[model samples]
Target: MSQETLFTKIINREIPADIVYEDELSLAFKDINPQAPFHVLIIPKKPIATINDIALDDRELVGHLYYVAKQLATEHGFSDEGYRVVMNCNENAGQTVFHIHLHMLAGKMLGWPPYTDNAKT
Candidate 1:
């Protein structure tokens, strides 16, 4: 088994989460600290640290994750308005968790100029 990440902890049922969606391959849940009225986090069950860490063989999995994110947005009642999907790749990019996860932000106007001036562009 892979070393337990914070996400693994949540997956193992050790930690609590407001799960919005789940399947054999992935899981979606509300973020503990939300940035918007309808903020959620989508993550794969596999322990992929980041996008750069993914193997070519995992291409399908990667695509599936994004599709699931879209599905969750539709199911969660944000299909009409729209939402933003974000993935922080590394520490320099403000990635708080090592495990790869997608943040779904909606329910309000999303402004440009992110959390910090250090954004890569």
Candidate 2:
């Protein structure tokens, strides 16, 4: 079991979301704060809090998340061009919502290094 989160509420339909896709095992929705023109969040119905919380039994669920990402990318017409699928593990990695999810972003030429910084090199 996992703790309740904002996503859990979204999953349970207590909160409204810009939902795009949903199957028996997972759901895909738009990010409230989209980082790109095409930013979507793919999450599992089971509500595993973090990547570290995943167990061997979750292998298929995890893979299904990837599959959903690919499917969404293809459907949204960014598969050939390229896209990004990311999962933040903790605070340092920018995970605010505790529920594990895949951040799918595209619709432009995304750059590397992910983010800019003021840290001295």
List the candidates' TM-scores in order: 0.90, 0.94
Instruction: Write down the RMSD of all candidates, one decimal each.
Output: 2.7, 3.2
Model 2 clash pairs?
none
Candidate 1 Cα RMSD after full superposition onto the native fold (Å): 2.7
TM-score (C-alpha) between model 1 and the true structure? 0.90
Stretch of 10 with least lDDT, candidate 1: 112-121
lDDT of 1 by residue, 13-36 (tens): 899999988999888899888888
Error of 1 at 49 (Å): 0.7
Evaluate all candidate structures by whole-model CA lDDT and list the values in order: 0.84, 0.90
| Local accuracy of candidate 2 as per-residue lDDT tens digits, 49-91 | 8899999999999999999999998898999999999998877
